[model samples]
Target: MLNQIPLEHILLLSAVLFSLGILAVITKRHAVVVLMGIELIFNAANLNLVAFSRHDPQLMQGQLFSLFVIIIAAAEAAVALAIVLRVYQHFNTANLNQIVTSED
Candidate 1:
């Protein structure tokens, strides 16, 4: 069933996701939203990895690498969130612009 879907379609979806994630990271002010965008980028990469790995069932390198990415992403999210929480507690705001302005 999975093989029925064309690779172009999957690639296109991943591209769209990656683009949106980049836009979010660039434009969004809230720390959490920025984290979400980063997660979206990670997911887009994972989708591409899985999509490509589907072609070669024997090697499964892409899938393994994607799994590693997932693990790293989880750890990164936890640490990032902790830092964000600490910043929020100290600054009373999650907005990057506000934080910068207050710092200045």
Candidate 2:
């Protein structure tokens, strides 16, 4: 029943998700929020890849590549979060506006 929706609709939704991710990444000041935005963007990309894979029965590699992307993203998030925590510890603030300081 759900398959009635056109491929255009799925693409539109993915575009919206990607836009929201970009907005969040640009507008948010917290590192965690930025990371969340990045994850959202990654998810949007994964959705597109999966949709394409499903559309093309002969090409199943997209889904496999998306799976790899997810794994890599998870590792990236972990490392980024650790760095954020260390920055917060040293600066006593998580706000991006307040985190940047002299390079001395």
Whole-structure CA lDDT of model 2? 0.90
TM-score for all predictions? 0.94, 0.90
Q: lDDT values of the candidates?
A: 0.96, 0.90
Model 1, residue 89: C-alpha shift (Å): 0.4
> Which candidate comes out best when scored by TM-score?
1
Lowest lDDT block of 10, candidate 2: 1-10
lDDT of 1 by residue, 7-101 (tens): 89999999999999999999999999999999999999999999999888898899999999999999999999999999999999999999988
Which segments of candidate 1 are over 4 A away from where they belong?
1-3
Model 1, residue 37: C-alpha shift (Å): 0.2
Give the count of colliding residue pairs in each prediction: 0, 0
